[model samples]
Target: MSTLTDLRRSMVAEARRRQRLTWLISAVVLVALPWIFSSSFSISIMTQIGIAIIFALSYNMLLGQGGMLSFGHAAYFGLGGFLAMHAMNYIADGAIPLPVPLLPLIGGVIGLFFGFIIGTFSTRRAGTVFAMISLGVAELIAALSLIFVGFFGGEEGVSSNRTKGPDFFGFNFGPDIQVYYVAAFWALIAAIAMFLFSRTPAGRMANAVRDNAERAEFIGYSQRNVRMISFCLSGFFAGLAGGMFAIAYEIVTEETLNMNQSGAVLLMAYIGGVGYFIGPIIGAIIMTLLRTVLSNFTELWMLYVGLLFIATVMFVPSGLTGLLMMHGPAWKRRSLKRLLAPYAAISIPSLAVIMGVGGLLELTHFAHTTSMDDRVMTLFSIPMNIDSLLPWAGLIALFIGGVLGVRRLRPMLLDAWADANGAGGGD
Candidate 1:
């Protein structure tokens, strides 16, 4: 019994040490990221990533922690953003004495206010009913934005100048780097707060209610209360993100509160793996890069994102983080190296398929969208004539060959995965 107690203590100590190390590494990364990508454009993208991280994590509080799938969480986000934009305008006019750094708090308060009102009714049910109610609220708010154009700014949306606000220290947030730091600071605070929330008894109860509400109720807990708390918290963080968005872009538009915006956050949370706290963070990073970087190069970025989402849902229901975590057993057993070769083997065909499909998409898109004179399209740094048969044949061959290759190699990869994970090792 003494030995078991010591072992448990050691395990707990190790976990604490690991958690500290992770936070330290994250801090270093956040501080170093600006210098690593010194361009203003890159800093802008990073700032957006930080905002996305906050938003995605907030959404996870609902879907991941509370087992509530929200199709309209962006209502809080948009509402917060709109109000923040208005506040910034007031600051510019010297109407409000609040500093720009504290603007997100206003967004949080607004989010909490709305979340309470919405959750009061929405949290009464779970599953499909809750989702539908959330959707209805979102649509109602979205329509109201148009009807009440005085506040929502109609189609043009509300705009504000961040530099017009009171300065923080010696900085007026006139530069992208300054805004990035502000965003990073808020994001760090929000992430840590959300993480702490997840460890609280209320948070655990939220999970219990999520998994089995009847069971939770039988244990002297009100499922509605648990869910309501989570919803409000989620709204606060999401609104905080919206405030960041307002500061970053100096504008809040109706599009920010639209169905598309809500859908994007959903994609971030779900694709990132709502099961893990860090999952939405990873998803936010990837999706932001896809939106800001990939869209610059391709018109079909949304299509690609959609395909990736579908693939994740079908093959990796646990999200990207879950997929990574799946290898923990093999890593712990010191057998991860054994799967490297199999992974490499499978990656070849996977790359082929991705390139082939993307190339075909570009080719077809170019053919339909451009004039006959614009027949040649550059792909992989090589010029290919969309009007010619050679490029089509090459892409088709690559796709077919990749499909065949994957079909042949999947079983071997699975067996290797099993072996690496110790399922086949008799350990």
Candidate 2:
């Protein structure tokens, strides 16, 4: 058994090492994805992903690593977005430097300014009290957005043009693809920076404070200071993400400063898995994909997402990243291979059923603008039509099959997860 354990550990270590290399290669691939793909829609998706990635990491800084929850996070995001837009206008009008790539810095400063002011009070209390104070803060700022029409632009919001910047060797950000690269670059940078922050001493101290405030204080770390630092850092990066938004869409509105944006970020970060950095990245990617791609398919996407969120909270508290990681031991033992066929069998049909229903619903409603329109996108060029009773019958059959497979496989998956954890006393 010890030999098997050693072998498993060695194999796992080897796999992890290879995964690192894979990631590096994948990062390069992603950065160049714009050049490779000719679709303008793809670039738009990538830009949304970029903004989401930064936003998720920033939220995680509050919830995941810091162990604090703030329902009013949108205040900073909106402020940052608003300020960045102003910065863009300043540059465009020759009031500031043209080709302003440092717009995120301006956004961060705005976020930190608020964080500095608010942290003075909110950092005093942790948990529920802290959450409420943050909510109040968000509401206050949201109200302020309406009142301060001159700066915030009230209901009309603020807009800017990126082409107003200086031409860098005659490369104007006139095209969406060019802007996509800039967004992707910043997204990657923000992700790497946030990941590094988690490994920093301050970040670890935040974790210590989160897990046990009394013990962290007992160890000579000021819990107050720890919380303050976390709040500020979270605001800083969130502002940066907001800046990305301001630049990406060229607009900042009350909606940005509202509870909905904050709630979306909270949901994304938490559902991705707060305990893991990669979790938010995954969460952000999934949410953005759903928002940009799935929503175009069906208005009912939110309903399904809500159901999935509830299911995750109830059954998979750790989110998708954690659930996937739960299979580590079985993977190490080479036993996980046995389940691959079953997983594919279940997942493929299930995805088809879910996405098919979603796609058909959108077609009926005429909500989508995908390349896969009924008139253009035919399966095997057979002129498939989903606007009929036959397609509905197939959908019903698929749904029933997926439900049955999931119910049957769920218990087995749970057992395997338990085995994986117990096998190595993994936390």
Candidate 3:
């Protein structure tokens, strides 16, 4: 028993050490990223990613931690952003003496206020009913944005000048780099706060209510109250993200509160893995990259994202983090090497399949959107004559061959995966 206790203590120590190291590394990366990327565009992307991280984590607080699936969470986000923009404008006009860096707090408060009103009724029910109510609330708020043109600013939305706000420590925050740092600071605080929340009694009870509300009720817990707490906190953080967005872009449009924005946050949370604390952060970064960087290269980016979502749901419902975690047992056993050959074999065919399919899609899109006389198009940096049958045949062959190779290699991968994770496996 003593030996077991000592072993457990050692394990706990190691976990704490790892957690600390992870945090230290993350801080270093956050501080160094702007310097490393340097470009204004890169800074903008990084800033967006930070804001997204906060938003995604907030969404996860609902879907992942509390088991509340919201379709209109963006309502709070948009409200927060719109109000933050207003605050910035007020600051600009000397109506508010607050510094620009403090705008997110205003957004957070607005989000919490609205979340409380919405959550009171929405949290009365769980599951599908809750989801539907959330949707209705979102739509209602979205429509009101148009009706109240003076506040929402109609279709164009509200705009403000971040630079007009009072200086913070001799910096006006007109530069992208300065704005990025501000976002990074808020993101860090929000992330830390959310993390701490997850470890609280309320958080644990929220999870309990999520898994078995009846059981929670039997134990004298109010399921609605637990969910309401989560809902309000989620709104606050989401609004905080909105404030960052407002500061970053100096605009809060109707699109911020639309279903699209809600859907994007949902994707980020689901793709990142709602089960783990770090999952949404990873998802936020990757989704931001896909949305910003990948969109620059492909017009079919949305279609690609849809395909990825389908694949994640069918094959890895736990998201990208879940997929990575699947290798834990093999890694622990030092049998990871056993699956490398099979992974490599499967990856080749997969790459070929993706390339072939992408090329075909590009060709189809080009043919439909462009004039018929535009028979020549570039694919994979190679100019191909779309009018010719040879290119079509080559692409078809590549796709078919890849499919066949994948079919053959998949079994091998499965077998290796099983072997690597087998009970008796070792280095």
Candidate 4:
């Protein structure tokens, strides 16, 4: 009994140590990143990433913990931004003597208010019914946003001057770097707060309701109440993200609260791994980077994103984090190295398949859409005319070869994985 007690204490101590270490590492990285990059564009992207991280985490609070699939989560986000913009404008007009940094809190309050109103009824049902209601509410608000031109500012939306607010320690936030720091600070605080919330009794009940609402009710807990709490909290954080977005861009347009924005956040959360606390953060960073970088190269970036989403759903339903965590057992068993060769062998063909498919897509798009003069295109430094058959044949051949290679090597890869995972292999 004494030995067991000592072992339990040691385990608790180790867990605390690891948790502290994680926070320390995260803090160091957050503080050092801006200085490490030190470029205007990099700073801008990082700021966007910070805002996205907050947004995605908020969505996770609903879908991941509460099991509420919201098709209109962006309603709160955009509304929050709209309110924050108005607040900023009020400060500029000398009607309000508030600091700009506190504007996000206003957004949060508004989000919580709306969430409570919506969730009051929406939480009565779960699954498809709740999802459809959320969608309807979103559409209603969107339409109302346009009709109420006095508040939503019509199609042009609203804009604000961040410089008009009271300065924080003499920093007027005129520079992007200052804005980046402010966003990073809020993001860190929001993330830590959300993490703590997940450990709370309400959060635990939310998960319980998510997993089994009927069972949760059998234990005298109100499933609707748990969901309402989660929904409200989720909305508040999402609003905070929206406020940051308004600050970052200095403008809020109709696009901010549209279905497209809602879909984008859904994609971010789903692709990031809704099951893990840090999954949305990873997803947000990857999605933001892809959006920023890929748009510069291809007009079919959305198409590619859609394809990636479908693939992730089919093959990696747990998202990128799930894929990473799949390797944990192998790592612990010290057999991960045994699978490296098979993985390498499969990766080359997989990459070839992607390239071939991309080439075909580009070729198809160029042929159907581009003018005659623009028909000639360069892919991987290889100039090819869309009017010709050689490029088509080459791409087809590459795809076929990759498919065949993957098919042939799949057994070996599976065997390697099984070995690494300590599964018995057949002769």
Candidate 5:
């Protein structure tokens, strides 16, 4: 009995050590990131990424941990932004003397209030019924935004001056870099708080209810209460994120509360891997990069985003993080090195396939959309006439070759994977 207790204590101590190490590393990285990329544009992008990380994490609290698939999560986010904007305006008008940095608390409180009200009824049922109710609530709120011109500002939405709030420690936050630091601080705090929440008994019961509500109820736990608590907490974090958005942009528009925003957050959470705590953070970063960087390069960025999401769903249902986690067993066994060559062999053909498909998509889009005088289009820096057949033929050949090569090398990859996982002869 003493040995067992000692072993458990050792394991708990080890976990705490790892947790501390992780936070220290995260802090170093966050502090160094802005310096590494000091450009104004880069800082702006980083600010957006920070906001996205908070939003995605909040969404995961519900969908990933509580088994709640909320279709209108953005409602809380947008509402928070709107109310935060109003608060900022009031500060500007001298009606309120609050500091700008602390205004997100108002958003959090409002989100909690609405979340409690919504969750009271929504938590009565789970799964599809809850999802439908959320959708209806989101739609109703969206429609009201258009109708209530005083607060929502009609189609134009509401705007504010974040700099008007009382200065914090002699900083008015007049620059983007200053705002980035503030966002970074909040994001780190929110993340740490959510992580701690996940360790609490309420969080554990939420998970229990998520996995098996009936069993949780049998154990005398109210599944509805567990869900309501999770829902409200998720909303609070989301509202906090929305408040950050208002401070960063100084505007809260109808687009902020729309279905598109909700869908985007959902995609980020799912693509990042809802099963893991760090998954949404990765998803938020990747998606923000895609939205900002990729959109600058291509008009068909949304199409690419859709394709990536579909592929993730079909091939990597557990998400990118899940795919990464799958290699852990092999790494622990020191067998991962065996699959390196096979992965490299498959990667070349896969790259070719992706390039070929992108070429075809661009060419097809150009051919249908470009004027006769604008027939020339560039693929991989090579100018090709959209009206010509040569580019079409070349792209088709490349795609076919890539397809055949992938098929031929697939067995090698399979054999390598099996070997690494201790299911095959090769070692």
Candidate 6:
């Protein structure tokens, strides 16, 4: 009958005893999660989310936890994916005699090998210089992706048939669902392992160096060593994510290790709230869902993503998870209900405006085969599907009204924030 508070107290009282149980529970959950999914689609989504979470978390180790910002994280991730694809090929070709389940380890070893080499130079210069070096390194490799046809498969990249795996207990992984099981199992394992890593001595030192390298140096902790170690570990996990990605997608390309992939990692980690351990996980899941679902609905999705990213930096600098964390105090105080009305009032119109604008922008650039010539210039999200004047008038009215309402509400929202922070009374 112990609650979360009770569990926290017990952990504080006997850390080891509770930590062991936590890990054991995690193991069970990872094993059972795939079984809980109703369909292959759900499992596939979960697999991607889990891999992305691992990738985001590993990236955060360098950026958020170690304060060593990297721009070419995909170097490790893509390197790992390419290696795994090659490994899968080798397995298929009978060049190597390893089981498919252990193919990811090959990717990890390859990533760690390069991570050490890259970290040796990059870790020495942590900030902007390091970022540039990483970017250069990534571009170099990405160019190689097009040149090295012998190894990289030149533009086409590489593909590995997972069906090449030997049957285990009659499970040949012949179906996508079976592949999901494999991916899900590893995804969960990677997540739990990465989380465990965050609690270790190295992880704590990484945090210390992140906060104050000078202070860490004074405490006899070598900042360079700490940074290098973090870089290597982060690379290993990113590689693991790449391996999962390769297996899930069954293809590895130069694009996999390109600057865009690297940027995606940065976006996922920061947008998820890199300040917290669990932030990247939330970010990855939400970002993956958005990438999957939203891309289907719009061609100009990247524009909105850019807008969202800018808004996050400008207003909600803490990211989505941070916003969710903001709700904790109200929940703790049992006073969330009192603020519900205003929150809904502000959110509804705000969301509407966003969606309306988003829809219009997306439709203008849509790449779908069916294009209608009957121009229905819908304004402000009021379905002007049929070429009509009403839509135009409605759009203008909505924009003016929305802008005015938001301007007036801005002061109220600010006051609410101040009141919540105990700066002033609501009256």
lDDT of the candidates, in the order given: 0.93, 0.81, 0.91, 0.91, 0.91, 0.78
Candidate 2 stretches with Cα past 4 Å from truth are 1-23, 348-402, 408-427
lDDT of 4 by residue, 68-139 (tens): 999999999999999999999999888899888777888888889899999999999789999999899988
Candidate 4 weakest lDDT stretch, 10 residues? 418-427
> Which residue ranges in model 1 land beyond 4 Å of their true spot?
1-11
For model 4, what is the alpha-carbon lDDT of residue 190?
A: 90
Candidate with better TM-score, 2 vs 5:
5
- Model 6 Cα shift for residue 255 (angstroms): 1.4
Candidate 6 displacement at residue 419 in angstroms:
5.3
Worst 10 residues of 2 by lDDT: 375-384
Candidate 1: give the clashing pairs.
none
Q: Mind giving the per-residue lDDT tens digits that candidate 1 earns over 1-427?
A: 6999999999989987987888778888899999899999999999999999999999999999999999998999999999999999999999998889889998888898999999999998899999999999999999999999899999999998888776668889888999999899999889989988988999999999989999999999999999999999999999999998999999899998889999999999889999999999999999999999999999999999999999999999999999999999889999999999989999999899999999999999999998857789999898998878999999999999998999889999999988897784467
Q: What TM-score quantifies how close candidate 3 is to the native fold?
A: 0.96
lDDT of 4: 0.91
Pick the winner on lDDT between candidates 2 and 3: 3
Cα error of candidate 5 at position 203, Å: 0.5
TM-score of each candidate structure, all chains considered together:
0.97, 0.82, 0.96, 0.96, 0.97, 0.87
Better of 2 and 3 by TM-score: 3
- Between candidates 4 and 6, name the one with more favorable TM-score: 4
What candidate 3 gets wrong by more than 4 Å, as runs, is 1-14, 423-427
Give the C-alpha miss distance for residue 324 in model 4, angstroms.
0.6
Candidate 6: TM-score? 0.87
lDDT of 3 by residue, 1-427 (tens): 6999999999979987887787778888899998799998999999999999999999999999999999998999999999999999999999999999999999999999999999999997789999999899999999999999999999999998899877679989999999999999999889989988987999999899989988999998999999999999999999999998999999999999999999999999998898889999989999999999989988999988888888888889999999999999899988899988898888898888888898898888887788867789888888888888877788888888899999999888888888989845544
lDDT of 2 by residue, 246-317 (tens): 888888999998998888898788778888878988899898888778787556777667877887899889
